[model samples]
Each structure stands twice: as structure tokens, then as C-alpha cells.
Target: MPTLIRPFGALLLLLLLCPLAFAQPLPGVIASLAERAPWSDPLEALGTLSADESVTLSATVTKTVAEINFADGEQVERGRLLIRLEDGEEQALLRAAEALSAERANVLGRVSQLQDRNLAARADVEDRQAQLDQARAQAQAQQARLANYRIRAPFSGRVGFREVSVGTLVTPGTALVTLDKLDVMKLDFSVPEVFLGRLSPGLALSATSVAFPDEVFSGEIATLGTRIDPVTRNIEVRALIDNPGLRLRPGLLMEVIVQQRLRDTVVVPEAALEPSGDRHYVMVVHEEGDDHRLEQRSVMIGERRHGEVEVLEGLDEGELVVVHGLQLARDGLAVRLLGVMDDHTGVREILEAHR
Candidate 1:
């Protein structure tokens, strides 16, 4: 063969043997990735907002309201006067009883002097003493009834709707008002009764309310209902959160996330896996027949976080798992070698800068 022909043949052989080694590379596109991390048990649910401290206010006496010291939905201090009633008649009775008791005391003293001189019968002295005791008892009773006319707040809280107005005749058993202390709010949620044993007071949780979508509130496992709701088959639980501004109101809907347990399962980006009915699967690149090929792998998913999923099996650490472009990849499909895509750098930078 001629020298030029021989050189051309040698180059052709090199091309056939190393197709990937010598071709002008296609544009280096960013390859997607699925990074594995330690999986943790995630708990999530929806709930309703409630005040950690809530109570009702009611009238304690039967009388016509003389004065209303508070307006509806106002904050009140503990022991602050809230309502006043007619007390002039009761006050007069108390005063008259006191004068009569004073007169009875003087009579008892005279009777004691007569008895000491043996001029009065013992029975007579006893009768006068009994009369003085009855007068004093009547005076004490009148004072108690009069004191009840003035109603005061039992605690510092935000009052609810007013059932009656000034000059409204109210009785002892009337529904007066409601008080809600919202400084520290509570969230009432429910979980399947099967998890009842796992719940306890003081468990930490994170919650959100529609009123403040941007903020996350901290709370704790405050209480759990003793009996499950038979119709719902769910166990009611409550969490307490500090709300200094009283922005959280009772009966408002909320979302709650609780840390149920700790786990060490494999975690991957949610994009890496595809759901197939009950089972989940992902694509992984592996060496097959002297060439790199994509293989379909079935993985058992446990929990989810953002765009991530927990892989209970079928994945290992340090192994590359396609993230974004996996839907386009097929089993045994040849993929041109590109660099692994890393989206975590931005997250790390943000956290580092914050620190």
C-alpha cells in the first residue's frame, strides 16, 4: 500500500475502536443528579387553631346591670371591674342589720351584768345572746349578696361577644361572655388512633396558619384526647405555641408538621424516582457489556421532603442517580458523558452566608 493510504487506514481503525475518544464533543450540557442522604421520619397533617388558654365568663348574680365597664372584644386585666348592678337596697339592709346587731350587743352586756349579780335567769341571758348572733349573721349575709352585684374579670384575656348590654336584666345562670387568652395559642389536630401510644406531652412541632403564610410557628404536644372519636376513628391531639401578639385566633384552620421518629434510611431527590402504582422506581447508569447503560431500579420509598424521597432500599451511597432528565432516559440507553449537576451548592452557600 502507498504511505498515504496506509496512514488513512490507521486513522480509520482508531475511529472504529474509540468512537467516544475522538469525536468533536457535543456541547457539555449539565447532567441532573440524585444525591443520597440520611432519611428521617416525617410527620405531616392539617389541624385547627385554638387558644392554649380559653374560658367562658358568666354572670354570678341576679340583678339589673347598672353599669358596663367593658366593650366587646376588649382586653381586660385580672380583677378589673367588668359590670355593676343595683346595690343600694342591699347596702341599706346591711347597714340596718349592723345597727340592730350593735343594739343587741349592748343588751347582751346588760344581761351578762344582771346574770353576774344573780338578778337575771340563765335562760334569759342565753335568749339575748342568741338574738345578737342572728343579727350578726343577717348582716354578713346581706354583705355577701351585695358584693356579688359587682362583677369582675377572673383573669386577663380577650373577651368575646357581649350577651347583654347596660341596664339589661341578667340572672346568675345567664351566658355572659367568653374569654380567650391568645398570647400562647394551641393547635388541635388528629391522627389515626393507631398512633395514640406514640403521642405524649412535650413533643416538638412546627405549624403554619393561613393568617400568616410566611411564618412558621413553634409548638409542643400539649395534650391528647383520652378517647378516640368513634366516627372519625382518629385520636385528637393538641399543641401549644407562643403567640405574643395574639395574632392567632381560635377556630382558625392551620397546618401542622410533627417529628414522629428518627430513621437512617436512604434519601434521594423526589425527581429521581417515578411512582408506579404502589411501587417506585429510578434509573441508574451502570457498566454493561463493555458500555455504560441506564438500568431501571425499583425502590421502596418511606417519607418525602420538598423534592426528595426516602429510599428504603434499591439505592446506595456514592452512586449516581439521575434527577431531572431521568424521564428521558431508558434502560440500556447510551448517555453521552456529561458532568453531574449539583443544585445543593446554592443551598450551602446561602446557609454558610447566614452563619
Candidate 2:
């Protein structure tokens, strides 16, 4: 009986050691080093473009159009004569006023000479002076009235299509053309009230238009609405963009992206994140001699942009995180370092290159 018991004890010891001898080898995984990078979560909204200055030109008096100096859609300077009405009558009246003014000056000069020589009464000299002043005032009035017959540009801008042709009789307030200063464009958009705290004048923004698909227009916040819209819970924002090329026009729809504040933070590939319920975790790989050991760490994450996740806590720059073969990773699990991933390379590329 003693010999049988010894043999059974030896067999039990062999069974216990067999499991350890046949254990599976550690798994292999791809990892990436966490690094610091500038990051910002941009805010997006739709906006409309408008000229820096805009106006509609119209006739201020009833007159027949004698000459239209500007062509349709012409660029004009300030005070440039744009149209001339039938001014023959005004010209004749101005000539007559000038002649009368000349005659009054000549009579006043003779009367002043006579008064100095005591050949004329002092009252006569004073009366002649008053008549000369009145004649000059009348001439000045006629000159002003003559100016009303010509239409001139109010400011430097691009003019729209002409609404009336020469010989067309225009009444007061008759529409003539539209003018806009297009050197700078004003972009207006709305943002939710929740983002109001983040917005301020001079904040940079970029805009894109379907009309110019390949071009990106840049600008900054110029002003903010004084009051928020209670019904929509939004606030209006205006940005000024330099439109040197005059490509942007009024009433153009564009997509706007407001550049938020940038921050430097540790980031890792999104593939390395292990989400469970509302919590997130990453398997951090620690180098142990020639082998690597993974420690499942809970990390506080902030923003996720592109394929990278911003690690707010529990991660540091220069640390390695498992990105591929995460399904085989766990706390305290041993892993083989297959390869490293980088910002410019994908996981599949790294894995295939290692193979």
C-alpha cells in the first residue's frame, strides 16, 4: 500500500506541472507614443457675406437725363460725375445771374469812389453796397441750383447696372443704380447663446463658399450683437474679411469656422481607447527588458479631433499606448512589441511593415 500511494502522489505532481509547461505565449500588439500637440475644437456655423458699404443711387430732382457718363457695372471714384440731366435752362440762368452780379459790382465800385471824393451821399454808397451783396447771393444760389442738374458719385465704389438711359425723364427719388464698396466684406453669422462666452471681437475665423469651392476666405470677428434673440437662443456675430480681389459679394452664403483657443496636451490614437459605459481606458505598455507589459489605465479625456483623443489625465507625453490588438490586451498581460505607430502612418501600415 505504501508503494501505490507514492506512485499516485508522483502522478498528481506531474499533472500540476503540465499546465504551466503548455501555457500559451504572450500576445503581440502595436503601440504609439503619446505626444504633446496643439489642439483646438473649431466651432462651425453658416454665415452670409455683404459689402463693407452699400447704397442705391437715385435722382434727387425731376429732370430729363441728358448724358450717362458711367457704363453698367463700372468702378467709380468719389465725386465722379455719373449722369448729367438737361441743364441748358440752368446754364442760361447762371449766365444771367453772373452778368447781373458783374453790373452790381461795377455800380458799387463807382458809388464808393464818389463817396470818398464827397461827390455822392454816404447813404447812396451804403445802398449800392447792399445791392451788390444781394446780387452776389443770387448768383451763388443759381450756381447751387445748377449743380443739382448733375449726378455725382457719393463715394468710391463699384456701380451696378444702369436703370435709366439718356433722354429718360427721372422724377425725384428715381432709382438710378446700386453701388457697393467691395474692398472689404462683412460676414454675419449666428451662434448659440451657450458659446457667447467664448466669442469676442478680433477672434479669427475662416470661411468657405460653394461658389469658390477651392478658396478659403479668412476674417476676424468685428462686432457682436447687443442683445441675444430670446426665441432662437442665438446671438449675431459679424466678421470683416479683406476682399482685395472683390470676389465676395453681398448676400453670399458661406460656411464659417471659428478658430478657438489652442492648447498643448498629450494625445493618443483613438484606437487605443477602451470604452466601458461612460468611462474610458487605455492599455499603457511598459518596457520590461526585451518584453512589454500592459497596464489598463483609466484616463480623463477632453476633446476628440480627427483620429486622436486628447488625454486630460492619466497619460503623459513619451508614454506608449497599445493601439492595435487591443482585444487581446488586459491588465498585467504580457505583450510582444510588434511595431510603433506614428501620426502620419496608419495602424495597418505599421502592422504590415513589421510583418
Candidate 3:
């Protein structure tokens, strides 16, 4: 029993003498410090691209379409005839009315001359003038009726695909076509009220369409809605883009990039951010006497650019941040600095790999 106790005591003494290593302080890569420098202005929400103007063409009266002057999907100019109905009777009436108007004018002129010669009542000249005016108004009405038989373009734009054809009956309420003016385009998007202060009119913006993945359309903030939507707690924003070639169409799905929102921020690689629960963090490296060490710090992040994040707070300029192996890190742990993560070898490199 004494011999057994001696061996057990000896083993316990050896264990007590051993100076255990505390898990090598969790390995991580050090990211070299970037002086708190001015970063690009950040953007928060997206926008869409729409037509600058969408005009709905409508008829003024009920009539059977005699001829569709413009073909489907036609580009029309202002005042150009787009459709025509049977107008023989209306045209004839207009001509007769014009003749009557000319006769009334002649009578008025004769009455005026007689008044000058003291051969006519002042009332008679006035009556003749009124008759002439009525005749002219009748002629104008007939002219408008004739014009109604033809549908004319109100503005220069591209006509949407038509659902009507020759001989099809239509009315004043029927939608003929949609004429969209896309020389300059518009974008309508929404943002939370929290970003209300960040949004400013005339800020530069860019958008990309899924249909054309390779293209990016640039634009500017045109206007903002006066009220917020109660259901979404969001406010609507409008952006105007120049579609010089008329390539973009209405109802296009897009991804928008609004610029120049944030004044100054520090941009860092996304890998350096360590998120836990509701907060985010980044490990900072420091020296202790003769040993290198790590310290965990909370960070306030702002906008994200590609694979980098904007550090809003909890970090100073010219501080080393940990970018890799943060899952095994702790506060004030002794660390060995092999090398530092850099623009070429750190988060920037990770983002390029994904891209």
C-alpha cells in the first residue's frame, strides 16, 4: 500500500510541476493597419429604372376604327396621325360650315360699312357680328368633330403594342396604346424611414438589370415622395436616368447603387468582422512586454462595398485587425505574429476569389 501511494503521489507532483499552455492563444492572421483614411461615400438602398413619361393614348368618341394609321410598336412624332375612322359626313359638314361662316363675315362687313354711312342701326351691326361669331364657332366645332375621327399622337414617343385593329369598334374610354417617352428615364424605389436623412436629391446613382447583366446605367436622384407608406414605413424615391439610345424599357427589374451618402468612414475586409449575437467584433493585435497578443473589440459597421465593410466605430486609424481564424480567439490572449494580412493577401484576396 505504501509503494502504491508513493507512485500516485509522484504522479500528482509531476502534474503540479507542469506549466500548462493555455491553448496557444487561438491562432489568427493579423491584418495590417490602414490609417483612418477617407473612404468612398456609402449607399444603403436600391432603385429601379422606368420611363420618363408614360402617356396613355385614348379616343374622344365612340366609332368603328376604319384604319389604324400607325402599325403596332411604331415610333411616332407629336401631332402625327395614329388612327383614322370613317369621316366622310363630318368632313362634308365642316366644309359647309366654313362656307356659311364666310357668308356671315361678308354680311357683317357690309353692316359695318352701312353703319359708317349712317344707314344701319348700331344694334344691327352688333347682331351681324354675333351671327358671324356663331357661324365661326359652328365651323370650328365641325372641324373638331372631323379631327376626332383621326387619332393623333400627342407627343413623340414609342407606341406600345396595340390591341386594336382596323374595323374594331372603340370608345373614348378605350386605351389605344401606351406612348412611353424614354429619352430620359426614371427610377422609382423605396427606403425605410431610418434612411430618410441619408437620401438627398441629385445624388449620383447606378443600376443594373438582370436582362443585361453586363451593363450599368447611371442616374441621379430626381425627387422624393412627401409622405411615408404606413404599411411599409418606407418612403418612395425617384431617380432620373438618361436613356440616350432608348435601350431601357419600362417595368424593368434592377439593382440600384446610391452614392455619396456617408461622409467619411474606414473600409475594411468583411473577414475581419466577428459577429456574435446582436453585435459584431474584430480582434486587435498588440504587444505585451516581449510577447504579441490579441484583444477582442466591438465594431460598428456601416455600408458594404463588394467584400469590404465600412467601420463606423470601435476602431481607430492605424490599428492591426484580425481577419482570419477568429472563431478560436479570446480577449488578451498571447499570440505569435507570423505575418500580417494585407490588401493583396487578406480580405481583398478573398473577395476576388468569390468574384
The number of the candidate with the highest TM-score is 2
Q: Looking at candidate 2, what is the lDDT of residue 235?
A: 98
Measured against the true structure, the TM-scores of the candidates, in listed sequence, are 0.65, 0.75, 0.66
lDDT of 2 by residue, 94-124 (tens): 9998999899899989989988999999999
Give residue 133's error in model 1 in angstroms: 4.4
Clashing pairs in 3: none
Q: Order the candidates by lDDT, highest first.
A: 2, 3, 1
Per-residue CA lDDT of model 3 for 1-355, tens digit only, reads: 8989999999888778874732334354556663454555545566666677788877788888887777677778999988887787888899899999999999999999999999999999999999999999999998877888888888889998887888888888788878888898888998888878878898888888887899888888889899999999999999988786788888887787778654666767788888889899888889778777888899898766777888888988778877765766678877665556665565556545535
Greater TM-score among 2 and 3 belongs to 2
lDDT (Cα, tens digit) per residue for candidate 1, span 196-298: 7667788778888778999988988888988888999998898888886778888988888876764566666676777779888887766466455677889
lDDT of 2: 0.91
Say which prediction, candidate 1 or candidate 3, comes out ahead on lDDT.
3
Which stretches of model 1 miss by more than 4 angstroms?
1-45, 53-56, 60-62, 101-133, 263-301, 311-355
State which candidate has the highest lDDT: 2
Position 124, candidate 3: lDDT: 99
